[model samples]
Target: MTSNPPLPVRPTRTAQPGFPWQHFSMRFSSTPRGARLARRLAGERLDAWGIPYGSDAHHTLTLIVAELSANAVSHGRVPGRDFRLCLSAEGTTLRVEVTDTRGEKVPTLVEPSDALDGDGGRGLLLVAALTDRWGWYPCADGPGKTVWAVLEVGTT
Candidate 1:
């Protein structure tokens, strides 16, 4: 009879009650299609996390991802590097972060466009208006940056 290897032991931890922060991260090519995918995936993930379909939190978070992902693809795209999207829900607040490989390029928020002209710069502006708070930070690993936004799940 062959001896089996020792069974893996599972560590016991005190279970914490109440709200848990769930994290989801994904990478996509820096392209228009990739940006759209990021937004759709975010909504799906939020639904799976029990945030409720068509809730205020769900729509706001989805829009935030759409804008950030668009900026990443359009302004922050590097030659071969991909962009990353990370979403996490902590307590009643949901945080969305989109990171791109270009560090030299940064996005700014501005007043909403009053022009009837097409192809205007208004992505970040919309993000600022929708999100409770939003900002960008240099990537800890260097050579990239992360733009993040936070919104209250139920509170406007």
Candidate 2:
């Protein structure tokens, strides 16, 4: 039930806002390899934005992306359709958004005890624990759902 983040308005088509923000968005095939590639590329983008590889922020964000991506591939996947990952970093707040082509499988954080059998299912729990905030919503642009996580890079 989380709301979508507001995007800055631009007066002119060629004008760029003077804000310290970085964004990366890409669509990937809804496969395990695609998820892995998304995670790696996300790390690269964060590093290019000065978070650097192996830093706490870099690691946390990467993990969040990986978990979200895995969920997109495993649960939300629609065969022949692709998933999308959108990343936006503004100052200390880094938001990770992964959208997949399935609306019925809304992500829910289950009880830890219920999922502690170790056959997986800890992804969301780990994301919830490591991130400042996280949630999902039905996609505004298409027929799917978007899972998101936010991290405060400065605090990490």
Alpha carbon lDDT of residue 83, candidate 2? 96
Model 1 misplaced regions, further than 4 Å:
1-19, 113-118
TM-score of each: 0.81, 0.85
Residue by residue across 71-139, what tens digits does model 1's lDDT show?
Answer: 999899997999999999877778899999888887765555542354757777777878889999988
The CA-based lDDT of model 1 is what? 0.82
lDDT per model vs. reference: 0.82, 0.87
Best by lDDT: 2
- Which tens-of-lDDT digit does each residue in 29-130 have in candidate 2? 999999999999999987767776767777888999999999999999999999999999886778999999999999988789977976877889999999
Summing lDDT over every window of 10 consecutive residues in candidate 2, give the lowest-scoring window: 10-19
Residue pairs with backbone atoms closer than 3 Å in model 2 (clashes): none
Could you tell me the TM-score of candidate 1?
0.81
Backbone clashes, candidate 2: 0
